[model samples]
Target: MHMLSRPSVLRFDWRPTIRTLPEGQFVAAIGDVHGHDHLLAAMHDAIRRELDELGPRSAAVIHLGDLIDRGPRNREALVRARAGIDGASAITLRGNHEDRLLAYLGGSPAALGPWLDAGGEGMFTQMGLDPWRISPGEFRARFGEDLARWLEATPVMHRIGQLVFVHAGIDPALPLDRQDPHTLMWTRRAWIDSPGPYPEGVAVIHGHIPRRTVDFRDRHRIDLDSGVVNWGILSGLVFHGDRMRLLQVS
Candidate 1:
């Protein structure tokens, strides 16, 4: 796969659909978008074609977050999501970027640089606002409702039969509902080192570390963050019962 620089975007072979679910297969966890609307569209098209081929009444789509930033159409992406296609099977999670925006809105200084450096500035710039000068109150007053609603529904972890879908990784030590947002949005090592029988029989399926491997340690948990903003395509896992398959976006 190739990721173009300048305005980074991923390029890779894309799959139109899944033919089999292997009995218990249900959810598809999508990686970060970082505002790459074109790639998102291609991904959506591929997903839809596949679903159309496979039937939407059977499987669900679980987007692992980082849905906005980097690319040019953050707002439009949200709008499309609001429209909800492929039979309303869309589920978007809150990535660290969204978390930072929430923190920025809630009045936090730590979020500024990271946000700006990671393309949050572009989104604000697109909206005709200077990322540096915006205040929390002002931010909330401006993007509050929509963002709040987006965050409110973003799931920390998705449990489908035995698979656990999360944006980042869970503390594994902390019980599911008890896990911290920080862990859910960033912790990597803890998730990798997580011993067995973690807080229910849930096999942790997650994203965050954008890599080529799709980085799976245990057969149960998988990471699909293929670094779309870095020019890597948004990747996903197609599960057939306990077996998992990879689908890349070009």
Candidate 2:
């Protein structure tokens, strides 16, 4: 997943198909929070204000994952996120970090080493779930049950009208229903650099690879991840009918 230091230049014009939902429907897709709970709350407040201003309408708030890791108060952030979406019409997708955490909790040898190396240990330590002090089975029984159930139930991709929300971009080569979860959560270089969008003129709204600003690289692909854990802004793209708006919190 090597992001181009300099994106390649292309000669042809790409007129992407513009998509829209019903007149009174709205959708908001948020980027990776990565344990930054304050930013998450701020973004939510902003969204609430926007929705209120738009008048009464059926709407959904979608969270692109990576909810924990590499920042302070991982457990608290998770709790906040869960509470935020608990009784609301919202969606939370599973990120690569969530997948790896599940693998570690299940004691998969292939995932344990890499998960620890990727800051899982620090997150567990901050949450007072010391992996060295408890067996994986005990940990699973004690701490992982509820969270794992929630994560396992989360969908890898969601479609609202013509827009698709996912943790990461899909491989355009595969049918939407047949997209692999692994690739949906972890793919980078190939998916991002691919030539076009999904079939049937559906646009992909995702977050995984971070950028300093919102990426409209391909007209049909919208990247909301601005890398909040790295001191970048946490952002959300609000879709209302045929228009889109950007909401952010630093």
Candidate 3:
């Protein structure tokens, strides 16, 4: 099993200091991490190191969801998330895999097969459970309260000052808040075609699809998922000032 970052206690005063972030430029957003525990830990550490070097700048980490799936370290990811980096908010979005996990808990036949096919098998293994044939009784006995925690904690989207962070892209035609659930994680060209720069001037940072799989033309959408499940390096974005540094997960 892979190891993930352990939870840390980082203090921050979100009340007024958050208003001090620079008024401009860019911030980072990370792609999907389907249970690749070690890679996510390395990426998180690297981003912190970058922040230390930059100093007193406003920035945030947009996590595009799927923290649990194939790699076997969801618990670790949660711990790290609870640890905050000063002046930086770790915004984690909900992914389709997460939806399936919730549905599986509710005994949804539709979610079971696909969840298993999409590397959810590893997630089950990490939990010390079997995904192949998860009886309803098995879920209740094993995951127990942990399942509820995962669903309750997952976030749908974040609007950090001017940046909009989500697991996927916006509906383009509609306002960010009113976006359809399916479109958030499943949108493609249509969402990209709609005219607008997020909410007026806000830049939207999102992740779900792998960077390698999408056409470079659509790179404007900021895809961070580098497919770590298939030996693909985890990818992330670091924002400092008006420029964003693209990084591959170590």
Candidate 4:
């Protein structure tokens, strides 16, 4: 059995204007998995233990995406994510890597090179194929087809009350409905640099820009990606009503 290191709690200290989840709901939002299946499994175990302690109530596990590429065990990581943790309904958001994957698999000639350049070739290498030799069709047949379909069908964002979950940050200038899909999967500087209370009461939870720790410095957004592939640690944030806690496994 895997053990989760003791969690660090952060009480919700937002100004009176920020909204929080409804009283009984609980949510665990995980950072980019990046094909770290062992860490994913351990994280799931920790979340199960958490829900058990919380007793019966509404709860969910949201994977912030980038479940594939740049690491070993991409397929296994997807399987574990699809299977979900025992106590929570799992929601997987589509990341930029997934976007590139779909485009490449759909026969977009322009998408292949960029995808490969961004560590996408690692998946093929794991499957015992020369990354350059395998065609997209062959790769899909061996590893993607069903997974691709699932990824295509997954939402880019999910909203639960005041909290909005996305793989990357949203454009601060536009309303949620009007924001472009590409921005949701890839935006960084613009979203991070914006100053002001965004959209009144809504807080965005995302994973894209890797940091040494979960970043809570921003008042309107929370960055959960701790660069798992390079950092050797995977992070998760738990939201129960107005309170939050950080859970991690290395």
Candidate numbers sorted by TM-score from highest down = 4, 2, 1, 3
**lDDT assessment of candidate 1:** 0.67
lDDT scores in order = 0.67, 0.75, 0.64, 0.80
Error of 3 at 17 (Å): 22
Candidate 2 clashing pairs? Answer: none
TM-score attained by model 1: 0.78
Error of 2 at 72 (Å): 1.2
Candidate 3 wrongly placed segments (more than 4 Å): 1-27, 57-59, 82-87, 107-110, 132-141, 144-147, 192-201, 213-220
Query: Could you give candidate 3's per-residue lDDT for residues 1-250 as a string of tens digits?
Result: 4445543322211122111235543355667877766677777776777777666446667678787777767756655554545568666677777777777777666677877877677766667876666674577557666645656576777776666667767876677678787777667677656645555455566677565642233323455666777755777666654445566664
- Measured by C-alpha RMSD in angstroms, how accurate is candidate 1? 5.0
Q: Which parts of model 4 have CA positions greater than 4 angstroms off?
A: 1-19
- Which numbered prediction scores highest in TM-score against the true structure? 4
TM-score of each: 0.78, 0.86, 0.75, 0.89
- Top lDDT: which candidate number? 4
Candidate 2: stretches off by over 4 Å: 1-18, 85-88, 107-110, 141-144
RMSD of each: 5.0, 7.4, 6.5, 4.0
